[model samples]
Target: MYERKQEILTKILRAGRRTYFFDVKATKADDYYLTITESKKFTNEDGSFHFKKHKIYLYKEDFNAFKSILEEMTSFIFDKKGEEIISDHNTEQKFINN
Candidate 1:
C-alpha cells in the first residue's frame, strides 16, 4: 500500500528562474499545515538545467510567530527600500513593458 499526504490547497508563484510553492496539506489526524518550497533553476555547462529546492514545514503552533516576523521583515525592507525595483530581472521587465 502506498500512502500519500493529502493536499488541501496549492498556490504557485513564478519569479524569473525561481518558483515558489505554497501547499496546505493534512496530517494523518486531519490536522492542516503548510509547506513552502523555493525552487530555483540553474543551467549547467553541458547545456542542461536543474532545479534546487528548499522547503519549510510550518505547523499551526508557529503560524502566528511566523506571520508576524514575515510581516515585520517585509515592512522593514519596504521602509528602507521604498518600493524600488532593485533586481536586474525586474528592471529588465519594467523596461520591456514600458
Candidate 2:
C-alpha cells in the first residue's frame, strides 16, 4: 500500500463555501510535486454537513505547459469579461423569469 506523503509547504484559499488547498510534497526519492485540492462544503438535510474533496497532482515536468495554458485561459476570460462576477448562477433564474 502507498503511504501518504507529508506536505513540505501549504497554502489555502477560501472562496465562499469552497476552500482550495495547495500543497507541496516530496516523493520517496526526494523529488517534489504539488497537489491542488478543492474542498466544497455540502449541507445535509439533518442539519449536518460534510466536505467533498477533489484533488490534482502536478509534477515538475509538466509545470511550464500547465502554467502557460492556465494563464492563457484565465487571460482570455479576463479580456472578454473584465474581471466582473456578472450574471453568476444566482441571477440565472431571475433572468429567465424576466
Candidate 3:
C-alpha cells in the first residue's frame, strides 16, 4: 500500500485573475515530488465568480529535463519579446515563494 505525506512546502503566485500553487510533498517511500496547480477565476452571468483548477504532478527523476526545457522556452520568449508583458489585459505580476 502506498500513502502520501503532508505537504512539506508551498508557494503561491498571483497573476491577475489567476493563482498558481506550488506544493512540495513526499511519497510513501519519502521521495519528494512537486505539484503545481493553476487556479483561474471566472464570472457567472449573475456576477458570481468560480474557480477552475488544473494540476501537474512532477517527480524528481525528470526535474532536470523539465527545468531545462522550461528555461529554454522562456529564454526563447525573452529573446523574441523581452520581459515586458505584451497584452491589453497585462496585469502586474506578483510572486510569493516561501
Candidate 4:
C-alpha cells in the first residue's frame, strides 16, 4: 500500500551552495539507517548538465558520532574557505511580486 512506502523518512540536515541530503531508509531486516549525499549541479560547455552526487551510508548505531563529526567537518571547511555571495542585482523580491 502507499502508506507502507510513506513510512521511510528523509530530511535535509543542511543546505548550502553545496547541498547535502540526509535520508533514512530500510534494511533487509527492516531496520533503519541513514544515507548522506552531496549533490552539486554543474553546467557543461553546451549548457546542459546534471548534478554530481557522492553518497555514504551510516547505520543507526553510529548516528550520534557521525552527526558530531559531520558538524565539525563542515565547520572546518567554512572556516578555511570564505563564504560566497549570490545575488540578482536587477530583480528585487517586491518587483518579482509586482
Candidate 5:
C-alpha cells in the first residue's frame, strides 16, 4: 500500500516563455508547506522545445520573512521602474496579435 502526497491548492501564472506554479502541499504529519516552481521553455537547435524547472520550498516558519523580503524587492522594482514593460517580447506579441 502506498500513500501519495497531493497538493491541497495550486495556482499557475504564465509570463512570456516562463510559467510559475505555486502549490500548497501537506507533510506526513499533516503540516502544510508551499512550493514555488519556475518553469522556462527553451528551444533546442533541432527546434524542439523543453522546459527547465527550478523549485523553492517554503515552510510555515519562514513564511513571514519570505513574504516580507519578496514584497520589499517587488516594491523596490516598481518604485524604480513604475510598471513599465521593457521587454522586446511585449512589442512582438502586440504585433503578432494584430
Candidate 6:
C-alpha cells in the first residue's frame, strides 16, 4: 500500500548561488492543490542586495491552465535567452589563486 506524504504549512526560502526562491507553501481547502513562489536576488558591488518575488497560486481546477502557461513562459525564456554553455575548467581560477 502506498501512503501520501503529510503536507504541512511550510515556508521554504531557498537561496542559491545567484538567486533566491521564497515559497509560501499551502494546500487547497478541499481539492489537492499547492502554491509556489519564486524570488530572484541581485547583489551590488557595495554589498547591497535586493530581491524580486513572483508567486503563482495554483488550484486543482486550474492545473491545465497553469501548466500551459508555465510551458509557454519557459519556452519563451529559453528561446530568447538561448542556452548557456559552461566550460569544464574554471575560467576564473587564475584570479582566485593569486
Off by over 4 Å in 4: 1-7, 13-17, 71-98
* Best first by lDDT, ranked: 3, 5, 1, 2, 4, 6
2-98 in candidate 1: lDDT tens per residue?
A: 8999789888777777777889999988999999898889999999999999999999999999999999999999999987877645522211110
Q: What local distance difference test score does each model get?
A: 0.85, 0.84, 0.93, 0.68, 0.85, 0.56
* Model 5 bad stretches (over 4 Å): 91-98
lDDT of each residue in 10-80, candidate 4, tens digit only: 65533433466767788768898887788777888999978889999999899899889989998887788
TM-score of each: 0.88, 0.84, 0.90, 0.58, 0.85, 0.43
lDDT of 5 by residue, 1-98 (tens): 89888989888777778777888999999999999898889999999999999999999999999999999999999999988877656632211110
- Per-residue accuracy of model 3 over 36-65 as CA lDDT, tens digit each: 999999999999999999999999999999
Which prediction has more favorable TM-score, 4 or 6? 4
For TM-score, the strongest prediction is: 3
lDDT for predicted candidate 2 compared with the true structure: 0.84
Candidate 1: stretches off by over 4 Å: 91-98
User: 1, model 1: CA deviation in Å?
Assistant: 2.9
Say what the RMSD of model 5 is.
5.3
Write down the TM-score for model 6: 0.43
Q: Count the backbone clashes (under 3 Å) in each candidate.
A: 0, 0, 0, 0, 0, 0
Candidate 1 lands at a TM-score of 0.88
Least accurate 10 contiguous residues by lDDT in model 5: 89-98
Candidate 5 lDDT score relative to the true structure = 0.85
Tens digit per residue, CA lDDT, model 6, 1-98: 87554444444544342232322334434345565666667898999988776776666688798789989998897898866635565432111110
Candidates by TM-score, descending order: 3, 1, 5, 2, 4, 6
Model 2 lDDT per residue over 6-95, tens place: 889888877767777888999999999999998888999999999999999999999999999999999999999898777555322111
Better of 1 and 6 by lDDT: 1
